[model samples]
Target: METRPRGRDGTGVTNTDAGPGLVEPVPGYRTRVVDEGARDGPAVVLLHGTPLDLRAWDPLVPALRATRRVVRFDARGHGVAEDVPVPDVGRLAADVVAVLDHLGVADAHVVGHSWGGEIAQRVAVEHPGRVARLSLVCTRASPFPPFGELAASLRGGTVDLEALLGRWFTPAERAEPAGAAATVRAWLRDADRERWAEALDMIATFDGLADLAAVAAPADVVVAELDAVATPAHMAEIARTLPDAACHVLPGARHLAPLQHADAIARVLLA
Candidate 1:
């Protein structure tokens, strides 16, 4: 079945409905696929963080499409994708490769936010040939510190979305997330608890500090000054380790900068 996730307008506001462009890969898992931009332009894949689906990129897609073919999808176990086991980062990267192969993209600029950033890091190092440019947004070089507490809380099989959202957005955004909050809540409500927990576990234990320098692709490290998890300092450290990487921090933004400051993110990615 094909569906169209409500496409967002130019100002980065998210609409609370699914729009067109869903595809089921012949030999891959089912995930919501939103392909935009010129087919002949350079391919770029946008990966979202935990709990949030591909729609998180609705606001940024237009800007990205101006210069490249932007491909965004729901990672497995989130959004419309199947609730498969959350294997190691290598396997997760392979899944991304499968998506790219299905789309006939030989290589792409891989942009990942938060947990997805961790996956992108692994992909750049493990599957260098498939990644042309690596952009890590609001990401860190070590395990997410809050994972232990998050895992323990999820043991009861309930997600305190309010609390989770609190950490992701700034005070202004929390007060008025401009429809993003509603969209994320809907996504989490539809998500499987076990699969989400598994993804969290994978993020909690992920540490790519040692192999970061091995990433051959030119990299861009973006961070939000107000982000508690992937702090600016942490992102700077990551930039220092990568052989070809630069860091940019958005003032007053939080962990979910991609959604909060879509234009700024697009500027960095486009630059």
Candidate 2:
């Protein structure tokens, strides 16, 4: 395993030397498993969203590791797994399944943020046997009204990545923006523009409203009170769809609530 500076968390990121355990070829991508805590503990899978990588969960992983085996990996177009094409929601969920199968994990508590949440929901719907529980943070049940426009705009030209980051973090977070910027830069460095555009296209065209009612897993829907990306109403709607889901709104947080309120999210997920 190799180690590298992953910002202020003190814990150096662990690179899986031989790639995560998997039977079939993942086509263009590789997987890395960051094994933490007891090997026999409950498995918890963490998935990050667009413009960010696995490191986005750095602050929360340690907290979660105290009681469970926290597994975090970069999405196909996002981190170390940079070779896979940007995929639709179903394919994204399949990627999660592939990771679990590779690691010999039968079932796990799945936690996802933003677009990652969409993938998580699909996993619960399509591959229900593999997901033990679900946690959706700053995510929506279906494609938002403005997603098409946003995807078009992103495809048109270069995006002001800094401005996008500014909108996600609170004023206090913006005070020390280096940490967040570095995370975003790492994702950008790993992702191709065409792949990112394709991912956005998939997101814009996705429709999951009809399938949400079939989800039977226990779920927790977390929303940031000040989130501009996925509004609180969207989070509430997601909670409403699941038969056994509950909602929690984090005060004084923006779209990046999972990062700002990592402890709280970890506590809820572990509980």
Q: Relative to the true structure, how large is the alpha-carbon lDDT of every model? A: 0.78, 0.73
Using Cα atoms with residue i matched to residue i, what is each candidate's TM-score against the true structure? Answer: 0.87, 0.86
236-267, model 1: which lDDT tens digit per residue? 99999999998898988887787669999999
Candidate 1 Cα errors over 4 Å, as ranges: 1-28, 170-172, 175-178
lDDT of 1 at 241: 93
lDDT tens per residue, model 2, 2-40: 112342333443443233322232666664456456568
Residue pairs in candidate 2 whose N, alpha carbon or C atoms collide under 3 angstroms: 21-102
